[model samples]
Target: MSTMRDVARVAGVSAKTVSRVMNNDRYVSDDVRARVLQAVDELQYVPNVMARSFRSGQDAAIGVAVPAVTGFFGYVVEAVERIARDRGVAMYLTCLGEDPDGEQAAVEALLARNVVGLLLAPVADDQSYLKPWRERTSMVFLDRRPRKLSAAYVVHDDNGGTRLAITHLLDHGHRRIAFAGDSITVPTTARRRTTYELTLFDGGVGMDPFLVSWGAHRVPVVPRLLALPDPPTAIFSANPSCSMPIVRQLHAAGRSEIVVLGFGDFPMADALTPPVSVVEQDPTELGNQAAQRLFRRIDEPDKRLPRQVVLPVTLVRRGCCQRARMGPAA
Candidate 1:
């Protein structure tokens, strides 16, 4: 275990100089900094993270809480981790994995570990559990905002993006565009469902409650919808997990005539028989921007009011929705 004293002795500098270099103080001359770093590398010295934080009265590390380390949230985690690295900030990553109790526990554990701030993609319906730590910790919500709690956050334009997808279908003469998604109680799902309905109504298309399906078993839902006497001419899936399964099921059922568009892009989405068209939200930007906001709050706790940032989205048309009406009926 190499210590700061060891590095200082090897570099022929006082321990105080080594401490200054570790803190990244501008007062340390460039020549001294180089020697200290070289000595640190050669000695394989690692600083005590908690001790460093205690000495500075703040942790340079920030904690990130997400649903999981894959899919949409995975991209966000990568982006946040990259941005944190570039900014010379440490990161503590935790995945809550669809459990409300786990979400609360992750936050508590991050706080207990003394992270300076948190970037959270919340799962809990009510975040009053975090109220006690609000004063001491700086947190920025990502993907979804906390219910009944005021905090800084970054989210995509859910309504606008879904509207774009529905409108694109409408332009292609899709009269009945079915929507497949998960439980609407989730904030993102709720916003997307609301937008899908509102778009249909605003486009002068009649809204049929039967056209909407909710659950993880969207593969079965699609077949039932297709069985309807007045089946949808096109379908809009609101999230990535729902999107991929819907496409696979439709393809397997030999129902390629039914057009499918989705809310997020996936691997090989463009490689399908007819590549999938999608409403693309920038997950990287979502994570990067959320982390940037969290860092700012950590640096200047009282500098600004809580903010809500909505990143823009675009509808990426690959071969999926290219053709005009071959008559509206499927």
Candidate 2:
């Protein structure tokens, strides 16, 4: 309950001097700073961040918006929280669902709180509505690029990673490979799906529209794909959200013979019966880099133009997707 005025009274210094000392202002003499510190310790004073934000017309907080908090996005949120805590800043997080209207509403709610910056994993196809707020808020896109808004972003190399996964399957002689993932409306999934088709075409494998499943996150598509007259020999899961459920379904159906290559690694991926091969994208690195970029923009808004950073991914082969040829299920 001890305020700056209480510390100033105890330290025999003016409130302004207390404020300067609290802010680590160099103009205050060493002796005066020492007195303020002693009084602060004596009174157990804690700075009111909310009051400070109100007075300065800025929030000492940032916002993070993502599709869901589970799986890969959870790791991203954890990393961003760590960075915010380390920097002595508060974080306000929201889940912006697949709806474009919901995405806009959630983001606008964060902005209404006067958050200094935002780290968004946007699901909306168009973000032109965020144009007006660009001048006042430091925005950084994570995991996916903004559609119409040009802003700083840190994302995985979705194209390269998808190609790597598809090529791995092709090298394993999986000509009939299926692509399972969220809707192509999602920018990341769209990029991955495009790369998946291109890689298959270049590898002399024709695209099978029947094998590609969108909205695999919400619906069980693997079983339907397996029931096809010409079932896929291998399946390329585009993201962890889709990957985990597909793997679970395969396990439940006792279809360990089918090969699977997930785009993002997930928890217990190596513990499954056939395990799981993955094109590993570092969510932690993505979150850390995006949060750092937002902080940089928040601190130095005019230092430079917004830049885009694409992090590389690697293939982590475990148990599945290693077959030399497609054969009858075991």
Candidate 3:
């Protein structure tokens, strides 16, 4: 148990300066801070986090309850973990598996650990679990936000990202464009579906019920759409996860004429046969922003402002977005 006095003596600084360096007070000068750290390391001195917490009253851990690691949520979680590591915050990652009950359970468990904050993608629209613990912890929702919870959040503009992909297809002279998404139960898919339909309607393209196909949350509707009398010239699968079934269906149907665009960037965007073109969400930036926002909230909880940050997305065009005038199938 090397005391602050030992560190101060070796570093030639006051005991008060040692305390400032340990607590990251940011008031100490650069040179003194460096020497203090070197001395502490040379002495193999470990600060008592429990004692520090008793004095500072901070647990220094955040609870992040993520939805299943299937599609966009999975990518978002990965980026957030990196930010967590850089911030030196302990992140307790739990999978909700898209289950409302499971999400509730996870939240309860994290709260019990005296977690200072929470980053969540609200699984259920009904935030019954949040009512009691809302004040105890600062909660930030990621990806999909709940309707009623008025707390701070970080989410991609689902409407804007989808609009970019759809607009690209429309601009490429593909009038009979179609959309494939999982059912409207999921908030993310539902928002994207709205964007796709509204974009077509705004462009004077009549709504084609036949062109819209739905599937299970994990399933793809490629086969059903391809079976239609007039298949779409361009297709926008809801997200990259949906791309697998769509591409697989295209190969199985032996149809290569239709152009395809995926919602989010694919890991192997360039390696695919046609190379996937996508509207990419910067989740790394999102995570960094989330951490920045969370710490700010923890540092100043009494502040009346609720900061909601929406990150921008970019469309990466590739060969897959190209299209040509196609004759009806034989």
lDDT of 1 at 41: 98
The worst-scoring run of ten residues by lDDT in candidate 3 lies at 47-56
- Model 3 stretches astray by more than 4 angstroms: 1-58, 70-75, 328-330
Give one digit per residue, the lDDT tens place, for model 2 in 269-290: 9988788999998889998889
Each prediction's Cα lDDT score?
0.83, 0.85, 0.74
Better of 2 and 3 by lDDT: 2
Better of 1 and 2 by lDDT: 2
Each candidate's TM vs. the true structure? 0.81, 0.82, 0.80
Better of 1 and 2 by TM-score: 2
Predicted candidate 3 versus true structure: per-residue lDDT over 1-330, tens digit per residue: 676689999999998788678767668889999999999999876554333334446576778887666566666667767655554567777777656656677778887787777888777666655778877677777777766666788888889988888888888878888888765666878899999999987777887988877772366576777777777887888876677678777767776577778777767767877777888887667766776676667645687755677788888898787754675435
Q: Which residue pairs in candidate 1 collide?
A: none
Ranking by lDDT: 2, 1, 3
Model 3, residue 83: distance off in Å is: 3.7
Name the best candidate (by TM-score).
2
